[model samples]
Target chain A: MTRILAVGRYSDVDAAALAAMGAQALPSAAALAALPAALRAEVHGVAFMGHESFGAAEMDLLPALRVIANFGVGYDNIDVGAATARKVLVTNTPEVLSDDVADLAVGMLIAQSRGFEAGIASVRSGDWQRRGPLPLARRVTGRRVGILGLGRIGREIADRLAGFRCQIHYCARTPRQTPGWTRHGDPLSLARAVDDLVVAVVGGEETRGLVSAEVIAALGPDGVLVNIARGSVVDEPALIAALEQGRLRGAALDVFWNEPAVDPRLAALPNLLPLPHVGSATVESRAAMGELQRRNLSAVLAGQAAVTPINAP
Target chain B: MTRILAVGRYSDVDAAALAAMGAQALPSAAALAALPAALRAEVHGVAFMGHESFGAAEMDLLPALRVIANFGVGYDNIDVGAATARKVLVTNTPEVLSDDVADLAVGMLIAQSRGFEAGIASVRSGDWQRRGPLPLARRVTGRRVGILGLGRIGREIADRLAGFRCQIHYCARTPRQTPGWTRHGDPLSLARAVDDLVVAVVGGEETRGLVSAEVIAALGPDGVLVNIARGSVVDEPALIAALEQGRLRGAALDVFWNEPAVDPRLAALPNLLPLPHVGSATVESRAAMGELQRRNLSAVLAGQAAVTPINAP
Candidate 1:
């Protein structure tokens, strides 16, 4: 009997890992809904991946669902409130992927500041020899940098930036004990205080559009924005306008409102460095995430608590 | 009287700064040689830039040249031995640009490891929509990283990587007081011990081809090579062969054997991230370098000591 349904796209390694645990694979939440009623009734937990929504309607399909083990740090797609209401535990793999996410965030910041895209293009097209030195890029070291959120991933990014000698400023509802780091009450104040702002906030209705137009403008014409958080956290149109009007210097984005199919305007900007949402996308991190997800599934299926539960349910 | 002749390329800001110091600008060493004997005789110092050879022949042309104020950290092109023999002091802008060089070095490491080139390409070409997530990149954080030469720039790179939780190992002729960092006696030992090797040795005859084929081989198929020091420090042909044969995973190069005109073979390799010698190429660092170069020029022209002399003559 299939005790677990591994939903969403899974790598071959992840699929094999799931199969070993008596779990059957489904391509997505839609696929899980299409499963025969008998099989759906047998599934006690879900090892979920991807950014597809899994709300109350999907929960009703699996009467025996005890837990949803999310394969990523962000659980915005899982509708935690609905899971809580239905008495189905929602667990997410965090901390394990923080290093990978922070690494990309810092990498993107440096890449944009140093104009890596133009530099690579010049070398590939033989333009370096033809045109001599590229226009000098801005220095990244010792600059003032702001973090939009001071969560697990945000703290990691700040810690890494400290090595670069950056003056770290962050915005959070309540200040934490981060010595040598300046704390701000709001995003606008934080953005105003720094030359670069990296979005590391959570993704959900409460935090949606947290990096609004005012925050972007406060960052000013010399400021750079790096978003490693959810796409909805930043106002895409405002960001687009800021770049288009030279109200902002540049941006490096790994996520977008419509990812995989990013807006053409954002993609066409010469000053923007666009990356396909690759945060937490590394062989090592993925393996760890899968292991954590499976552990959550195993614990919950055995009538115990989920390993990294989001709610008591 | 033109007390200082600013040789090689100069940005407008640098040229103006040079002019303020009662200096005249020449396009290159060739241009300096083309100057009339009377004009060359009046030049007390040469504020030099670029990678052109400046040996005894060029030194002989400027009979009254008291010092060469190089506008970059690397003074390899100045032929310091010849300067010493001729009783002409050689000064280079060093510490002022270390941060920028280190920044680019670390940036390139992360960029190459994360496959920034391919990620940017996929987004620009709209292949991200056509395709799904990119193949997982190797984790950069907490990896064993080796610095080939523990110089000022190399030390800076190691310091930054420490924040990423990297286990730092370095190769230096004589060990310094760097606690917690593993020091190796030779490049081969360093390569054998680490997953990544960053070349940060000085350039010139003594250090030419320091990262030879043997060293590249020891780094192995999973190893990455990052060269930010000088083109002469690494064996270009060996690097190309290693990448071509899959003997090494990848490389990120800021300097090349014949820069501006980088070898097409290296450029063609999918595994290599080739930059056009942009180690210290930033607006802030260049400005700082120019100021330091001028300070060296001014002091030398005034019959005092060169501020940052490579050789006292």
Candidate 2:
């Protein structure tokens, strides 16, 4: 009987699939602390959000653990290096959630730029004069659009906006090439050239605080800012100040400075369109993500090389 | 001195353009009432919202009205046939507000599919446990997108969704063979084939109440509906019923069945993403629209052909 652990809360476990394979479920203490020990002790592998890494401190509990299947495309939460050091394989779901997350980024962009909520309030307030018409704001067409970190998501955003006929520019570490996109070596360089700067960079040690004051200031007053990346990449204080002083025209952010708990000052901002980090938070996409995790875990149990191996790096 | 009749309440008029052209600006009511006197004196043209058709009834007011420059795009507001009969040139601003409006449509699509406002409320209510994680509800990709009314805006939307790799199908009066899109002859046929229906059709008599009960029923319980087009295109009561009983998956509408007074029931719906009509609402876009309007008005006053002639139709 193969033991399985679930580190994160998923909508539904495909019970039929596991049962068909004759696998015994062992949910994690963190995930299933309320369950009886008999139910918890039978786990062989753990499934987590974003293929999360268990530190060496927590690795002792899962002596039989062989694989961890993550629920999202981005696997930064799982310390690949640490997992690799312990000979633990990690698998993640990707590509399937690309369009979903990109859709969120663009949706947040429009909501922020156009004041969708404010427009609703104007009519809901029941002031006849306020219900005139939808204001024709300056368009994104033909505007210079800069991508802060041109990875999978960033490239997808570019492809999405291609029909809007925007001039695309991106900043990446290696200065690589992609079709129909201008490359920048640094964030500030990309900022200086575009009317809108979208931060789609990763989070963690190297990228933390990467979108500093200087890069933001370079974007200037007549620009728009968007962040669908993790909360750590941006200098939150700089962004909030720029918004408050009207130095930045508007901002759309899904990820915040802190997870779950956002700064009240940021929340109070009328110029900001704040969202609970919902990049890939769509039912079909999430279910696909979960199923992908299951497949990866099942493959590991079958002694096959796990697809999307995070520890390979 | 040349007089220009300005229609519509614009918050920011292009004072410099009017001043530079040496045209006297008269507010809408004032111009309408005093137009007869101004015609005999020395009025040059009418600067109005996209379309403000001067009927034969108002023909007496502006014998000298050589031009009618539309303030925005979509010239249906103006009686172009009447203007053409009077030999008054009509113009509309084109290619300016396309991207912004397209952005609005896509925003509505994402917001509805992802349950954006509900997700936000879940966080704001301090009921974070109820919310899903990085993977969200019904995604944007891979949906069979059926666009009702495939004009410029619809084309723009198709282009934007190209990256998502969605199967695109559209309905129009005459079959259009545009690149990268599959055209369906009728709305019912289009709705029958897709999980998502986006109303990007134009407004007015021809298109009013276009999305009928049959079409909604065809979309079924798992289908998502998005309306950034005129509200009159959809059947309100039918939509509400479909939503209430879960006959349709969800809906996102920028335009309401009625202006200012949305169906109170619709506003209270959990399966709806309701917004005030915010199509083309963006600062830069609005400014550009104003600029175009001013230019058109100036062109008419100068006795030149307006760039976009609504009266041509």
Candidate 3:
């Protein structure tokens, strides 16, 4: 019989469903290390939920673990190198949440560009009639938009934006086969080419601090930055400074370097539209992610190939 | 020489441009009525702005006025019947602002569904990490969306929503030739068919209170109402009552009946997402509208056909 270790804060419903799938619900990755060897030795798979660091040390505790299935498209929290080296397969839920994330990215861009906060405040503060008219917001449609990464989620954002008549520019290692979209050589160039930039790059060592100070500077005073990707990809201090000085127009961020604990300065800025790590937080996406995670766990436990494998065994 | 009257609050730049086009700039419609008979009688075209009523009385004052080129898509402020009865041509700036209006509508829907306010507050109040997790937001993708009037803006919204995998349904005077969209005969049937209803009907007497209490009741507790059209189209008191009683999920409104002076009750509702009447309040859209209005004014004053005519001469 296969035993699975489920980690992270799962809702009662999710926990119950995992229990039905025969997963032993462990609240945290730290809890797995504290488990009795007898119990840990029987665990063959992990149904992961939260952003807890899982490295070689944690992997060593689960000697019988054959697979780790992540509940999100971004699995940066899980050390794929360690899992691959240990011959453990890693799978992630992708495509399932792409629409939700892309939808948020487009929505945030429009909200920020359209000055939704001012609009809301106008109504809430009862200053709308007194103020006469709110300031005109920059247009979202027919403007130039740059996509940081032209991956699955990025492509979705770009495709949605194309309908708005935006001229699309993107930066990737190599230009893709997309027609009518301009390709830039680097992040700075990409930022310079468009009025708005949406970061959709993957997270990790190769892409860490990819959107640097130079890139932010190139984005200029009237440019808006929207980050639906990881926080590590952006220079937090530089971003805050630029926004404070009014060098950049605005930002709509879903991720942060120390999320949940986002920098107070970033939060205080009226121009910053901050969201919890909710790029894929919709009910439909969450259920699909859970289903995909379960399918991946069940497949590996059943000695079959994982559906959305992130690393080779 | 054809003398043109540029009415309403114009930006200094727009006023200057219209003056350079040989149009007399007036701050208000009342100013036009106050003009000397000699100056008023010479006015052959009016570049109108704002929502001051232009009825038979105003038309009687402008006996020489050949065309009223409205600076917005919605000309509910202009009595088309009176214009038509007097053999005066009425043209509106359409298509130019349609994309901007449609973009805002979709953005507001996504923002409300994703709980953008909570997300913004989570970061602003520095309670994101402390709060642990924000409540799951309803998904925008894959939901059924109903457009109250599938005109130009409605079609644009429906097209953009299709990319999100939403099922499109609509209510119009007659079923449009749009394939794959579910058409209903009345507003009540349209509300019943979709989870979200976006009011895109034209503003005026024929369509006033089109989305009545019966329609709202059909939309139910899990339903959201988005109004990007005129505020007069929706029953504001009924909407506010439903929101207060929790009979409806939420509403995102960019227009109000007495706008600028929005009902404080509607503004105070946590479930309501209020925007200053900014459906087409974007720089690009505003500039395009101004240009279109100028073109229409120039054409009619030059004894040429008016473009985008609302009422045939």
Give the CAPRI class of candidate 2.
medium
- So what's the TM-score on candidate 1? 0.98
Please give the lDDT score at residue A18 for candidate 2: 51
**Span of 10 residues, lowest total lDDT, candidate 1 chain A:** A1-10
Q: TM-score ranking from best to worst?
A: 1, 3, 2
Candidate with better TM-score, 1 vs 3: 1
What is every candidate's C-alpha DockQ against the true complex, given to 2 decimals?
Answer: 0.86, 0.52, 0.77
Candidate 1 residue lDDT tens string, B1-313: 6477888889999999888888888898987667899988887789899999898999999898789989888978888988999899999988888888888888888888888899998998899989777898878999899998898999999999999999999999999778589999989999999999999988999889989999999999999999998999999999999999999999999888998788999889989998888878888999899999888888877777777889877
Candidate 3 lDDT at B219 equals 89
Can you list the residue pairs that collide in candidate 1?
Answer: none
- Which residue ranges in model 1 land beyond 4 Å of their true spot? none
CA-lDDT, candidates in order: 0.90, 0.73, 0.90
* Sort by DockQ, top down from the best: 1, 3, 2
**TM-scores, in order shown?**
0.98, 0.88, 0.93
Q: Candidate 2, after superposition: displacement of residue B307 in Å? A: 1.9
How many steric overlaps are in each model, in order? 0, 27, 2
